[model samples]
Target: MKFTRTANANWKGTGMDGAGTISTQSTTLNKAQLSFKTRFADGVGTNPEELIAAAHSGCFTMQLSFLLSEQGFTPEDLNTEAQVTFEDGTITKIHLKLEASVPGISEQDFQDTATKAKEVCPVSKLLKAAEITLSAVLL
Candidate 1:
């Protein structure tokens, strides 16, 4: 299966002074200059890193949820944060931290399941970073 989104940007001038608008028609961002400053710190709007984080988090969460269900355990909640590190204009590493409120599961089982999810998740496989690490907490 394939997924896609569209973004349009209009830039005026150069460097940080330039601005653009972004729209996804999905309620989050709609035709606004990327230089909004709050989210991107004077970023030109919808930078690659932010988009990568969104994709990684969404993919990891879905994969984890599916694994949990397959293991006969339902997850109360799963919180994931993904950090994409860039060095010299290249993505170096992706750090994924997942905190889950899962019941009736041992720590080892949870770790094993999470490992499987990380390995099988499409995003993880797609990422070409040198390192991808996952730290999962069961509560």
Candidate 2:
């Protein structure tokens, strides 16, 4: 099976003075604004790093659920947070923090699955160039 998605961005003015609107085919993010101040400083708008973090967190949570089900467990809840670090105009690292509640699983097994999820998730594979770290808690 194959899938495709698309997002477009339109910008005006210079880097520090410019502002852009980002739109996705799904329209979930309809013309979200992005600017240098938003990316490099505290400003109102969405940035690429924030978008990546959202994608990674969602993907990782889903992957963990799949792994748990494959291992004969069912997840009651999974809360994942992805932290993207941008330094010197480069994405340097991504940290995944997760709190999960799964029934009928040992802590060690849960941890193993979560680790594998971080290693094998699609987003993790795509962002392999950056340093990725995970801290998972089985609650």
lDDT of each: 0.81, 0.94
Model 2 per-residue lDDT tens digits across residues 1-139: 9999999999999998989999999999999989998888898889999999999999999998888888889899999999999998799999999998998899999889999999999999999999999999888
TM-score of each: 0.81, 0.97
Best by lDDT: 2
Error of 2 at 50 (Å): 0.3
Clash pairs detected, candidate 2: none
Can you give the lDDT of residue 2 in candidate 2?
Answer: 100
lDDT accuracy of residue 22 in candidate 2 = 95
* TM-score of candidate 2 to 2 decimals: 0.97
lDDT of 1 by residue, 1-139 (tens): 8878676556566555666666665747777556536244654556667778888989989999999999899999999999888787678889899999999999999999999888989899998555889999887
When summed lDDT is taken over every stretch of 10 residues in candidate 1, the lowest stretch is: 36-45
Error of 2 at 13 (Å): 1.0
